[model samples]
Target chain A: MKLPKKVKINEVVLRDGLQLEAKILTLDEKKKIFDQLVKAAVQTIEFGSFVHPKLVPQMANSGELVELISENPNDVKLIALIPNLKGAKNAREKGVKNLNFVFSASDTHNEQNVQKSTKDSLSELKEILSYCKEQDICLSVSIATTFGCPFEGEVKKERIYWILEQLTSLDLETITLADTTGMANPQQVYDLITELTNKFPHQLFNLHFHNTRGMGLANMMAAMQAGVTSFDASLGGLGGCPFAPGATGNICTEDVVHMLHSMGIETDLSLDELLIASKTLQQLVGHETPSYVLKAGPYDRKYSIPTKK
Target chain B: MKLPKKVKINEVVLRDGLQLEAKILTLDEKKKIFDQLVKAAVQTIEFGSFVHPKLVPQMANSGELVELISENPNDVKLIALIPNLKGAKNAREKGVKNLNFVFSASDTHNEQNVQKSTKDSLSELKEILSYCKEQDICLSVSIATTFGCPFEGEVKKERIYWILEQLTSLDLETITLADTTGMANPQQVYDLITELTNKFPHQLFNLHFHNTRGMGLANMMAAMQAGVTSFDASLGGLGGCPFAPGATGNICTEDVVHMLHSMGIETDLSLDELLIASKTLQQLVGHETPSYVLKAGPYDRKYSIPTKK
Candidate 1:
């Protein structure tokens, strides 16, 4: 039940949430949500992506948002998602202080998702990490489809380790093992986290989960047992796997925060403030979000209006 | 996972599911579901409750169903629910060889549920266990609202132990901790089961989970780690608390079997066969069931019809 002194939650609303929406959120709306999120005690946030705007139009305003996060960099850590060397260079030129790069370990998914072989991605990662070190910018590599691949049935644990070894050799301590397709049951979560943490005890392992099979929070509990501290969650359960199959949404930040704070886990996140931000995001997108606690309210909130049957 | 060599899945369709039905299930229809459940390899079945017929007409057919199960005594084990001394005696007179008697541990729930205080129910349990011992009948006590109570909120872990201690003193070897309203989360499940198993290592423990907030299977896994092997599940997620506030359905047997079997955990029950019985029960009741796995099929089931948008 011991959580870190201050666990950093990397909010992925702007990039992941907006990309999944049919209606693209305006730059002003995204700014408002990000601004509210920072006010709610979130120190670090993944503001946007460096993907091709043609592939994901929702990320067309990445440069504008990154500039905004940098201006108010007093207490906030800003990060951007990079798909390849092209994305990494684009983010570095924008004076990005922190970057998150993703590559799938499942060779089938590595070919299908980013159209690059795993070995090629490793070479590209080595090149990018050298530049990232020169620029003194923090780097984290997310090994996506780490749990199970839609095309390939099971992603071996050893493959995940080799990918981590390549990344960790570059001296970046932070890494995320994402259940991109939501195939992680608690057993898988326990086994993988246990293996990685035991091998690389000094590295700060972060977990990113999706709730497609309704095991999002369950997987988190397993990760916590393995001493994982930081996690990634999208506001309003807004992310989906556009390429991988059956990933409905990322774990709702508000729900996980609520559960953690209520259980004496010391998340240091404001439940009421998080709820307000989630509802605002829902309204900004002009659609109901999948966050249950946001819609249902906390246990003490007596303002739950009785529904008219 | 090491499961029992010959596990008995006690189907709760007739007793648990129809309790909350707006329209009662007839004896003939309930018997048909029971027959189908047996065909599904459910070797043990909780037929019905021997409560006041005026209070619950849905389970008035307990006597008849007991008679039906008795005819195939070698093929299956039949259990009847007894709420009080009157119900216990009535079920006993019907020649039921096995019985499950439930009483709430939370004082507030005990008052609201059975109109008796927790101590009063404990007194009554002593009376009933002695009666059953005299008749050479098997008995297991279940503590309703063991996870949390609607009126009492969080029931203490000590309360569960005290009750189990009392039941053991009455020479009852088997008891179940029923998550009556599904407030049982994984941490709570782990804590309570560990405490119970540590205190009474040799006593047979069982879990009764509700899928209300969608943690039924996760809680089951936690309990399994805590050394719980036996469990109770109803077909199609049929039951709810009569006095409990905003309670959802029981843990669906088809769904539970599917999850257990998929994890290489042997349940000694066929998931596909349980699903067929669940579908038949759903049709017999002429309503949509609460089980998603039954309608959506198992995780790897091909040819799934897309859910309506």
Candidate 2:
């Protein structure tokens, strides 16, 4: 029955949403969605990716996205997802303030997902952290598939802690755990968040949840109870897990903001602008996006008669 | 990392699903879905209701559906929901062996939902239980809104226990905790299930989950870890909160079955048949169902190559 204090919503629709869709958005479409996201007042946004544009052509215009986002830096943090040192350098050159390097704790998962072993990924991470420090940029080491993987069920908790222990030593800006495949249940999420937070009291942590198993928002709730403040979500529940096989949808940014804000949690986001962003994103994708709050139009939608009507 | 030994999948789609939709299903469609569900090897199916069908016309075919299911009951148990003594008497007359009665643990919720206070509902339940015993029918007392309520926000653990304590004294055959509005997180689910299982060692209990807040399956997993064996799910995720606003979708039976079976948990139902039933239900509803498994297909589908050569 205890209520959580604060929640920060990090919109990832631009990164994860476009990653899965067959419909790749143009630079203008991406800009419109990003503009709407800023208007929505989401504190942090996964503005673009630093991975090979050849593999993910949708993000070919990453440099341009950073340029447009910089026009109004007003308090909103624009984050970029970088898989390695090369990606980190590219992001830094674009003047991206926050750099998120993605890694996998499970060896089998790491090899299949990013085509590198966990050790090799860690070595790359070590290379990236120093450059980020030199640039005075915030570094958040994102551990993907921290829960069970679709290919490899039941990811051991010890393996995750070992990676986290390394991240702690690096003394980066933040650490984030991602249920990349949506295989996480609430207990695993709670256990991981609580254990990590307890061990690293001074460290900053973030949660990235996916709605593939329909536990995305619930997993977020468990993490919030365990004292997490920041989160990564996609507008209109964009994004599907690349390694998750059958999974779909990231945690919907508008849905998270709606729930958190209504519960008296300070998210610093506007619901109307969130919905507008979702609508614009939906048009870019050429299909209805996965956000419930945006599509359903809030609690009073059914009962609310328009003033004009 | 030890998997569960077995899982019980009870399809609440017929009664729970149709009631949540804006339009009503014809009696003929209900009969067809019921027949498919029975063939799906669902050991138990919540087929219909014996309430004032006028309030929920989607269940108007309940009487007819119950009669049809009775003609070929076989070993599969057919359950019917009864709200009060009148409904209980009607269900008994119709030859339903498994009768379920839901009552709210919160006094305000009980009053708002059913136009009766908790005490009045309990008084009515005593009559229903007495009648169920005389007819040699198995009875289950379900406490709804056990985790959180829309009207009152968070529901206390002690309130849930008090309701269980009262029901235990009534000599009911079974009991269950319903996350009726999808307000339950894993810790809450685990804590309540563990406490109840310990206190009532001799009695059996089940967990009912909703996907409104998207934690349905995760909470179910936490409950399973806590030693709960039975669950209530709707095929194709066809359900929502009746009393509480902003709720959406019951826990999809196909997703739950897929997760459990892949983990090597036995459910005695055919996965393919379950999907077929879900698809059929979706077709009748004229929409893409809420179940991710139905849309995403099995894990193997992710690996399948698109054929065009």
Chain A TM-score for each candidate, in the given order?
0.93, 0.93
Error of 1 at A152 (Å): 1.2
Give the per-residue Cα lDDT of candidate 2 at B73: 54
**Docking verdict class for candidate 1:** incorrect
Query: How high is the TM-score of chain A in model 1?
Result: 0.93
Give the fraction of reference interface contacts each candidate recovers: 0.03, 0.13
For residues A107-191, could you state the per-residue lDDT of candidate 2 as single tens digits? 7777765779999999988888888888898888888878766556667887877887778878777688888777765656777
| Clashing residue pairs, backbone N/CA/C < 3 A, model 2 | A17-A239, B17-B238
Predicted candidate 2: interface RMSD? 6.3
Residue-level lDDT tens digits of model 1 in B1-309: 222333335677788778888788777788788777877778778888988888788888889777766786346888888888888889888889888888898887777667799989989988888889999988888899898876667788888888877776667746878888766777678777777878987787778887655566667777777667788889888887554333447877886776666566677787877778888888887877767565444545322222335
True contacts kept of 2: 0.13
Pick out the ten consecutive residues of candidate 1 chain A with the lowest summed lDDT: A299-308
C-alpha RMSD values across all candidates = 4.9, 5.3
Please tell me which predicted candidate would have the highest TM-score against the true structure.
1
